[model samples]
Every structure is written in structure tokens, then in C-alpha cells.
Target: MILCADIGGSFIDFAVVHPDGRTEHRRSVPTPLDNAPAFIGALVALCAPWPDMPLHIAIAGVECPDTGIIHAANIPCLQALPLAAHLHRETGRAVRIANDADCFALAEAHFGIAKGHRNVFGVILGTGIGGGFVLDGRIVPGLGGVTGEWGHAPVVIPPPVPLDQEAAETLVPLFRCGCGISGCLDTIAGARALERLHLWAGGTPQTSRAIFEAWQTGDRQAGRTLDIWLSYMGAGLAHVINVTGSTIVPVAGGLSNAHALVDALDEAVRARILTTTSGPLLRRAALGADAGLLGAACLGLDIRAQE
Candidate 1:
């Protein structure tokens, strides 16, 4: 069994995972975000019961492969700390850590919808956009341990000229992203960003769900917002697909719940991609919430394989 923890800003989800992806002794605790020692202690106590097993963590942050420094914006205590190394010293157990999104991709490649695919790109379309790339069933490490961060770059293109109109009816502004970049896909593609886009497109402020629902009911204003969304989002994903050559994309997050929206986005992406495929490339992730823990297990399993 591997002691696996999915550490997010809100909670630390702990589980003992079998080699085949089954989890036991599952539990969760509120994460100690402000205090470093408390954060370390929480994990230590969780793993104490299984002293012989190694600990694998999937964190909501990036760990620098070169310096072992973890950069988690939400969990302030872990910033700049060599988390895995510190935990190994304190607990006397082998420790492995990876970005949560990377873990998600690894898990999906190993056991979920992308199981048979050698190249998988897992995307999270939640409050913010994030992604991870897995090649040949292993997480592809990058410089600064920041692989698959497709959302941060300036990729939004000028709105396409309308075919039958004298001028374009909608114009998408290059809103500044939290990453400090203008024209990033993240500014208009995430769930919250979708709401912002709805308002910017002359609709009253509404939740992403409400907007999608309104669009489904043929509300013209809502439809306009979603059209803009699909255009930029599809273009961004197509650029990613072209660059990565990923055979499949497993999508997870709040937006993935809307089957119709995912279908629409999938169709839009297919239309934009350079290469043709017999079927859709994007599929809703299969593992749901268990992806993080299961992914952490994959990390531990990799260590054992190396041994």
C-alpha cells in the first residue's frame, strides 16, 4: 500500500492505495495553511499508522525539480520549502511529490479514459484553467516543473471577422490575467471568466450554470457570450493539441459537468485543429474526485518501480 495525500488549500485528503488503484483507510483533515510545522505534522500523523509505506503527495502547487522548492500560492506555508525532502527527514519514509494536475494526468493515463493512449493531456476547466501532459504514461517534467501551463501565455487572437456583416458585433478585450499577462485564454475561458464574459457581452451577471442554461434555452445574449467563449477556448486548445500532438484529452472540473457545453467545446476544437481524427479527442475525466489520490498512488508506484 502507498500512503497518498492530495493536499489542496482547503483540505488534505489522505488514503492508503493499493497497486491496482483501490483506496482504503481514507480520511481528510483541514489543511494547516499558515503554519509550516502544523502542515508537516498533519501529514506526519496521517502516515504514522503505516510506517513502512512510502508517502506520495499531489499538491496544488509546483515543486521546482532543480531546487525542490514548492510554490503554492494558496498554501503559504509550503512556499519556498523543500517539502518532500523535509518530510522525508522528519518521517523517515520515502516521499514523492508532484503537481496535482500532473498527478491527474498520470492517473488518467494509467487507469482512466486515456488508459490506452500513450500521449495524454489532462485539462482542468474549473475556476481557473490548468493542465498536465503525460507522455508514455509518465508525467513529462519541464523546466521549473511547470509543464502544461497552457493557460498563462498570451494566446487569444483578434476576433475573426464576421462573414456577412460590415463589422464585427462583438469585441473581446484583452483582459489582464492573474498571471500578469494580457490576452491569456485564462481571462475568458474559466468558469468565473465565463461569467465575466457574459456580463461583458451585454448580459446581466449570472452564474456559469445559469448562463449555460440560458444559452440552452436560446437566449440570444447568453448565446453570444458562449460563442465568444467557444471561439477563444477552442483556439487555445487547438494550439495546445497541435504543439503537444496528444492523442487524447481528459477534461475535469466544474464545467465538465455540463455535458452539452463540453460537447460544444469539443466540436469547436475539432473544427480548429490541423489534423483530422475519426472521433472526438476531448472526453470527460472518468475518476472524478478520486483522481488526486489515485494519481498520488501512481507517483508512489513509480518510485517502487524504480527500486
Candidate 2:
């Protein structure tokens, strides 16, 4: 068994996972964000009963492959810390860590919608856009642990044509991202970003669900917001598909619940990509919340394999 933990800003989802990808004793605990000792202690307490098992973590952060230091914006205590090494020492067992998005991709490639695909890109369209790239059944840990971060780069720029006064007032061509970049797909591509786009398109501020519902019902403002979303996301994903040559994209998170929305995105992306295929390339993720723990389990299994 592997003690798997999905550490997020608000909660830590923990489980004991078998080699064959089954999970047991799954539970959730509040995350100690401000205190490093508390955070480590929480994990130690959770895994104490399973002393023989190694711990594997999927975190909402990046771990530098060379230095082992993690840069986590949400969990302040983990910043600049050698998370896996410290956890291994404190817990008295081997430990491995990976970005949560990468873990999502790994899970999808192994057991979910992207199963059997040599190259897969797992996308999370939740509060914000995040992604993971899996190649040849393994997670491709990229430079600075930011390889699948397709959201941060500046891809959406102001149009050359001058906007009408009303359009100019509502539209924001560039919005600063948490990563310090402006005009990124992150500004307009996720749940919160979709709400933002709805407002920008001159609609009342509404939740992503409401906007999506309105769009499906033929609301003009919501329709316009979705149009912009499709264009920007379609173009961005097309570039990623072209560059990575990923055979499949499995989408997860809150937005994936909107089947019609995802289908529209699939159509838009397929129209933009260079490849020609009859089937849909984007598929809904099957693993749901279990993906993190399952992927963390896979991480431990991979470590055992190498030894």
C-alpha cells in the first residue's frame, strides 16, 4: 500500500492505495497553510498507522527537480522547502511529490479517459486553468516544474481594430495573472475567469454555472462570453496540441461538468488544430476527485519499480 495525499490549499485528501490502483481508508483533513510543522505533523499523523508504506503527495505547487525545493503559492509554509526530503526524514519512510496537475495527467493516462494513449495532456478547468503532460505512460516533469502550464503565457492580445465605446468599456484586453504575466489564457479560461469574461461581455456578475446555464438557454450576453472563451481557448489549445503532439486531452475540474460546453470546446479546438481525425480528441476525465490519490499511488509504484 502507498499512503497517498492530495494537498490542496484548503484540504488534504488522504488515502491508502493498493498497487492495482484501488484506494482505501480515504479521508480529508483541513490543511495547515501557515505553519510548516503543523502541515508535516498532519501528514505524519495520517500516515502513522501505515508505517510500512511510503508516502506520495500530489500538491498544488511546483517542485524544482534539481533542488527539491517547492514553490507553492497556495500553501505558504511549503514555499522554498525541500518538501519530499523533509517529509521522508520526518516520517521515516520514502516520499515522493509531484504537481497536482501532473498527477491528474498521470492518473488519466493510467486509468481514465486517456488510457492507452502514448501522449496525453490532462487539463483542469476549475477556479483557474492548469494542465499536465504525460508521455509514454510517465509524467514529464518539465523545467522549473512548469512544463504543462499553458495558461500563463501571453497569448491573448488587444485587437488591432478599435472597439466601439461600449465594447471598450467592458472588455479588458490584459489582466494580470498570479504568475505576474498579463494577457494570458488564465485571465479568461477557467471557472472564475469565465465569470470574469461574462462580466466583460456586459453580463451581470454570475457564477460559472449560471453563465453556462444561461448560455445554453440562448442568453445573448452569456453566448457572447462563451464565444470569446471558445476562440481564446481553442487557439491556445491548438498551439499546445501542435507543439506537444499529444494524442488526447482529458479534461477535469468543475467546468467539465458542462458536457455541452466541453463539446463546444472540442469542436472549436478540432477546427483549429492541424491534425485531421473523425473522432473527438478531448474527453471528459473519468477519475474525478480520486485522481490525485491514484496518481500519487502511481508515483510510489513508479519509485518502487525503479528500485
Best-performing candidate as measured by lDDT:
1
| lDDT by residue (tens digit), candidate 2, 2-36 | 88999999999999998888888988999999999
lDDT of 1 by residue, 187-215 (tens): 99899999998988899979999999999
Between which residue pairs do clashes occur in model 1? none
User: What TM-score would you give candidate 2 relative to the actual structure?
Assistant: 0.94
Model 2, residue 35: C-alpha shift (Å): 1.2
Pairs of residues clashing in candidate 2: none
Worst 10 residues of 1 by lDDT: 161-170
lDDT of all predictions: 0.91, 0.89
- In terms of lDDT, model 1 sits at 0.91
User: What lDDT does candidate 1 reach at residue 122?
Assistant: 95
Q: In lDDT terms, how accurate is model 2?
A: 0.89
Backbone Cα, N, C clashes tallied per candidate: 0, 0
